[model samples]
Target: MPKKDQGLGPSAETPLPGDDTVVCGVVRHLGGDYLLAKCMDGVDRKVRIPGKLRKRVWINEGDIILVGLWDFSPDKGEVVYKYGRNEINKLIEKGFLSKEFINALSEYL
Candidate 1:
């Protein structure tokens, strides 16, 4: 058996903001399973990490995440996806993110 070669690029598909309900955000603060995320829409929302992803995903402050907004609460949302460094670069190249935002986010990284 031969070992598979893994490249430095993103291995899986990088999910984009699919619709109006999904938005891109930056994790600002982490408190247990909930975190304060600054959304691109200019709203600061309290986002929760669902039980399914709680143990599987290790979310941290300063990470770029996809948030699914709640219909009942405008200020609340749930973490749908987290972007890696390579994925973030791909997003920037695709014109989904601005360089200024990446520059600001670099402070946290």
Candidate 2:
């Protein structure tokens, strides 16, 4: 017998930033449920993992994430999504992430 094809594999969809409010970031530090991330826009924001994703997602430094900026606070935001290693590579290949950005992020890692 062969295994059934479920939609929960490595080929799972990787979400892209929907608009200007959402941007790519690299986790710089972990403080419990909150994270200090450096975004592509060159801002360091204190972002939190909302209750819906707090228990479901395990984020760590060096991981790539999508942050949804708060309307009232420019320095704060919430974690919208997390990307896997493969997804990161895909983003790079797709031209969503530039090589210079990834190289700069390497210093933190």
Q: Which predicted model would earn the best lDDT? A: 2
lDDT, model 2, position 75: 90
User: Clashing residue pairs in candidate 2, if any?
Assistant: none
Model 1: residues with Cα > 4 Å off, grouped in runs: 1-11, 21-27, 105-109
What is the Cα-based lDDT of residue 57 in candidate 1? Answer: 71
Question: Candidate 1 — which pairs collide?
Answer: none
Tens digits of lDDT, candidate 2, 48-106: 88987776677777778888888889899998788887888888898777768777777
Residue 34 alpha-carbon offset, candidate 2, angstroms: 1.1
Predicted candidate 2, C-alpha RMSD: 4.8
TM-scores of the candidates in the order shown: 0.76, 0.78
Per-residue CA lDDT of model 1 for 17-79, tens digit only, reads 765455455556566788877777778789998986787677777788888888889889998
**lDDT, residue 32, candidate 2:** 73
